[model samples]
Target: MNKHIVIVGGGYVGMYTALRLQRKLGKELRNRSVRITVIDPNSYMTYQPFLPEAAAGNLSPRHVVAPLRRVLPKATILNGMVTKVDHANKKVTFVPGEGEPREIPYDLIVMAAGSISRTLPIPGLTDIGIGFKTVGEAIALRNRVLHQLDVAESTDDVEVRRRALTFVVVGAGFAGVEALAELEDMAKDSTRYYRNIKPSDVRWVLVEATNRVLPEVGPEMGKWTLEQLRERGIEVKLDTRLESATGGHVVLSDGTEFDAETLVWTAGVKPSPVVTEGDLPLDERGRIKTTTQLTVAGTKDAFAAGDLAGVPDVTNPGQYCAPNAQHAVRQAKVLGDNIVRTLHGQQLVEYRHKYVGSVAGLGLHQGVANVYGVKLRGLAAWFMHRTYHLSRVPTLNRKVRVVADWTLALFFKRETVSLGEMEHPRDEFRAAVASNRR
Candidate 1:
């Protein structure tokens, strides 16, 4: 019987691991001795770092995602979710697109289901706040922000205009900071097109529970980021929490209350609930418990990585690996190699890598970075930010397209057109037919 290697989640781990396997085990794959299958809800893997640029209309959404089918031609790609893992019986229960659930037996399993946005139970959050995770959310946020500008420009009522112009973003992490900076820059540039809407009419606010922003970049850089944001007229409230957002009215813990049409939530993320559905051993945070070699604890034929796995950080000693693209990509390589070694009955290597640094884009031609204990800011850091991510964004085709976008942007102006109507394309047609019948 041929060996079946099943990989869950087609994000960085699933895609990269399969890619490495196909390369390393070319002979086994060609002889049909070992088969690989990958299951994921999305057909393409989203490069999450570029989401802020996509939200700001800086990069095309299509170019930021790499289709798994094209990238993993040899591996079987199943567009679905792994609902249950019966690891004891070596079977996995999966739900295909609009189909009945089925059980798949595998000789080896790789769990990398990734994670989802970690939200709070704040009032009206579910209805009003938008997350900055998927590409769809990024596109929706861009349209929503632009639409608010339109509403503010057309409305003469003071209260309505104020609400339309005020935009509040919860959290001061990388996602929130980048999203706020990029959108604010776009809105500032867009004001020239609206005669009645000046740049001063816009109100941008950043709320962080902690005393600083971008904690990954160290305290000095965090303080510098705060200064940069405040210099641009954005209100930065530290050690503040969002009490509630009932009816798009924001109430902060610092006794600040305001009405805003836009509320962006980028607090953090939690492991995918799929982790707990299985018989796998999980840490306190509901992440799969794994050895330093990327193999799940107490399991001989199972492996896990990425945001959903609690892999120890050898460099940090007492801490688990930070859930970031940098670690995910590197861990995937090690996990892939370890799987191959296990097949050949070889010793597995431990995962150990020192922390490098952090880089962030702060709108067009502006950024902040701290690499290898050296700090950088302004245009140089911005260029470094783009250069680094461009090298790490997967395929060459996507890299070229992204570069093309940046190239064209140099000659032309930033596009601020909103296609919010695309969200409900059939509404107009439905209304037209009803009117004609009447």
Candidate 2:
């Protein structure tokens, strides 16, 4: 029987794993003796760092994701869900093309199902809040923010205008900070075009449950970030929780009330629910338990890594590698090599990496970074943020395109048009017909 390697998710781990494996096992990949298959709902791996830029209309959304089929031509790419995994039986149940789920046997399996947004139970969160996860959400947010300005400017009602102009962002992590900063900056610029709206007329709030924002950076850098945001007129409410957000009327735990048409949720993420669907050993946080070599504990043919794996950071001793693109990219390489080593009967190397510090984008030419004990802020940090992620992004083609986007952005005005209605176009058509009938 031919040896088959089936990777679950086509995010960082799945794409890179198949890419490296095809390269390392060049002849083996085509010999029919070894085959690699990747299954994912989407065909592209999103460069999540650039999502804020895409949301701000600084970069096109299409440029931020690399197509899985084009990147890994040698590997069989399946656009479907890996619903069930029977590792003990060496087969996985999948539903392809809305058909009934069926089992596919494999000699080895790499479980790299990533994470989804971790939302709270706060009232009206699901109805009012927008998630900043995928490209569609990013674009929708951009549209909503810009369109809200239009709504506010055209409206005569003070209450409606106030509600439309207020934007609330939950969480202060990289996603929350970047999204808030970029969207705020865009909205600020966009206000110049609105007759009744000024930047001051808009309210931007960053609601963080913790004392410090951007805790991924140390306390000092985090403090610096908080101050910078406040200086720019963004309300940084630390140690505050959102009590409710019904009908776009947000009530804070600290006795604050606000009406906002826009609510962006970027709190954090937990492991994908797919992880729990399997019989794999999982950590307390629902991440798959794995050895330092990125292989599943006590399972020879089973392996896992990326955001879904509890990969221990040997340097940190007690801590697992944080679910960031930095670790995911590096871990994927090690995982691919380890898989090949295991197949070739060669020695498998343990995965041990240290922190390279953190970097974050804060609108146009603003950013923060704490890289290699060196702290950077403002334009320098922003440049570092772009330069580093550009290099870390999967392919050379993507790197070139992102760099080009940055270069071109210098000579042009940031686009701030909202396309929110694109998400549900039929609503407007239905409303128009109803008005005609009346």
Relative to the unseen true structure, what is the C-alpha lDDT of residue 163 in candidate 2, on a scale of 0 to 100?
88
Backbone clashes, each candidate:
0, 0
lDDT of 2 by residue, 235-312 (tens): 999999889998888999899998888899998898888888877888887899998999998787999998889998
List, residue by residue over 388-425, the lDDT tens digit for candidate 1: 99999988999999999999889999888889999999
TM-score of 2: 0.96
Clash-forming residue pairs, model 2: none
lDDT at position 389, candidate 1: 99
Task: Point out the worst 10-residue segment of candidate 1 by lDDT.
Answer: 120-129
What lDDT is obtained when candidate 1 is compared to the true structure?
A: 0.93
Clashing pairs in 1: none
